[model samples]
Every structure is written in structure tokens, then in C-alpha cells.
Target: MEPPSGSPDLVLAFANTHADGGGRPERFADVDGLRAWLRENGLDEAADDASPADVDGVRHLRDAVVTVLLGHSHDPATDDATVAAAEDDVRRVAARHPLVTSVDRDGARLAPAQPGLPGALGLVLAAMTELALTGSWSRVKACRNPPCHFAFLDRSRNTSGAYCSTACSSQVAMRAYRRRKAGSHD
Candidate 1:
């Protein structure tokens, strides 16, 4: 569905994906996909230049998303309420960033935006914006096992997917073993 305008959560969701069943990330990939999502979500469909967004613009916004994923200054006991609050934080960062929005305000409005982004870049931006409004952004996460930075959606029926891969989970188990063994000397 369409995301609220200038929403960071949408941006985050757009930029991050579990690639459905644990694979590489997927997105609009171009204007058509972007427009489809926008239209699906009832967002603005203004024509925008199809050039690549400025490196600093897209990357910094991406960093904001990554920062949140890394749980920057976040309480570890994150629940639904916490994720909702985080959506606002992402919105502010992305709205202030270059490509997302050039203007800043104490309270950003979710209005229809004009589109002019290149295929890949626009696709990413559009998806992220949509994610901000929807709870989809909440599912994006990094592996907790510490070795795997790979991102995934916590879609397990029990809402667990804390490890990126089984190997990482095994590694964490191995470390726990070493720790327990070392503690035996005490």
C-alpha cells in the first residue's frame, strides 16, 4: 500500500526487505514498480526526472534506516509501541534529508509528493516511504548473533528470526559453550 509522504518508516521499509523467504533484497527496480506501489497506496504520481538520486542523499537516508536497524540509542525491550515511535524518528530523518524533502519543519505533513527519481533510486525511495506508514517497517531487522549483518523480516509464526542464518545461531551457541566452560574454573 502507499506510504505517508515524507515518512521515514516508509523509506526504511522500502530500502530494507527480507527478499521473501531469505534471499537478496527486492524493490521497484524502476519507475514502473515505483509507480505501481505509489498508485497501489494512493500516493502522488507526479513525474520526476529519472536520474539517480545524489549519492549523499540516498546513502545518508539509508544510513538513517541502518542506524535504526542497529537499534541506535534504542531500548532493547522494543515492542509494538516502540516500533511505532521509531517510525516517527525515521520520518524526521528522511524528510530532512535531501532527496526525500528539502524543507524541514517542527511537524512534517504527509502530502502528495512529486516524483522524479531514476528507476532504481526512485523504487527504493518509494518503497521506504510506504514502509514508514505501514507496520511493515517493524519486521525489518538485523541478526542478533553478531556475526551476520544480513537483514530479514521476522515472519516466523512465533515472530522469531533473530539469527540471519543457522550458522550464526550455531556460532552463538558455540560461544556460549566456551563461556560456560571458562566459568567452570571460577
Candidate 2:
């Protein structure tokens, strides 16, 4: 398949696309490639809507991704917790490149080629780890919505990315249409 874009935020945001379209999980290279990447990555896709108390920062990240990506909300109260966790995960991954950084303290040496992004980050540890370790990584991107939160990689050669998917574009268009119909551009 075509490789993903290069930006870290974009990678994180686009973490859970239905890359396989089989409607079943396991048809992917990683969390991004899994048909149910979001659920698999969060480690709770199969669990019944977990309680917010169980939804720690890590769980929140996955849930928020689901909310933004799938429009799913088993419980709306968990929204805040999910958002916080997602943000933290994004920050942590963004800060450390598994490719180039030494998680160990003593001898500075290149780590073994562990698989996946975390491994890649440990190996390279750079702003461009997503690109250098994975496919051309600089093309990662976030949606261009003011209140909307989504991420995607720009495959366009010109690199003019502004959204996670056409659905979002359509949503914006529909909102605009309603506003125009009502003659109220709020």
C-alpha cells in the first residue's frame, strides 16, 4: 500500500484508519494498518465501554481517537478523560524518537531493530523519526478544522493537506450549506 505521511501529529491523528476495509481487525501492518487500528492500539476495542475510572490517560487517547474518528460515544462523560490521554500520548510520542534515543543511561549505542514506531523512535529519536524510520514520514498532518480534531498524512505531491478525510470536508460543506440556507453565517 502507499506509505503514510511524515509528521508525528499527523501519524498520531491518523493512527486508526480502516486501511484494510475488511471490517475486521488484523488486516494491517500495525495499528495504522489494522482494519480496527484504533481498537487494537488502545487495547480495549473489544472490551465493553470501559468505565472512565478505568479509562486512564492512555485509554482516553484511544477513546478520543474513536470519538473523533468513528463518532462513537458509549459514555459522553469519558470524553474529557479520553481527550487528555490522547493529548498526552501524542506529546510523549512526539517528544521521544524511539529510533535515535537511548532509553538506557550508560553506553550510548544504536538499539536493535525492534519493530514498530516505538522501536523506530528508540532507534532514531528525532523530529523526523516517523519519516526516517517508517515510510516518508514528513507528510503527517492534522485536520484544518477549528473545533474539529483529526489527523492525516498528505500524499499529494504538493503537500497541500488540510484534512483527515473527505467526510470531514463534506461535514464542513453541509454545515455551510445549512448556514447559507438559513441566511445565518454563524
Which candidate gets the maximum TM-score versus the true structure?
1
lDDT of each: 0.49, 0.42
lDDT of 2 at 162: 59
The best candidate by lDDT is: 1
Worst 10 residues of 1 by lDDT: 44-53
Cα lDDT tens digits, model 1, 1-186, are 222454444544444532333455433444454445444433443323322334344444444454456452232444546555555655765454334432356643333243433333444445555554576655666555543444556566655566656887788789889999999999
Residue 42: error of model 1 in Å? 21
lDDT of 2 at 18: 22
Q: Count backbone clashes in candidate 1.
A: 16
Candidate 2 lDDT:
0.42
Give each model a TM-score.
Answer: 0.47, 0.38
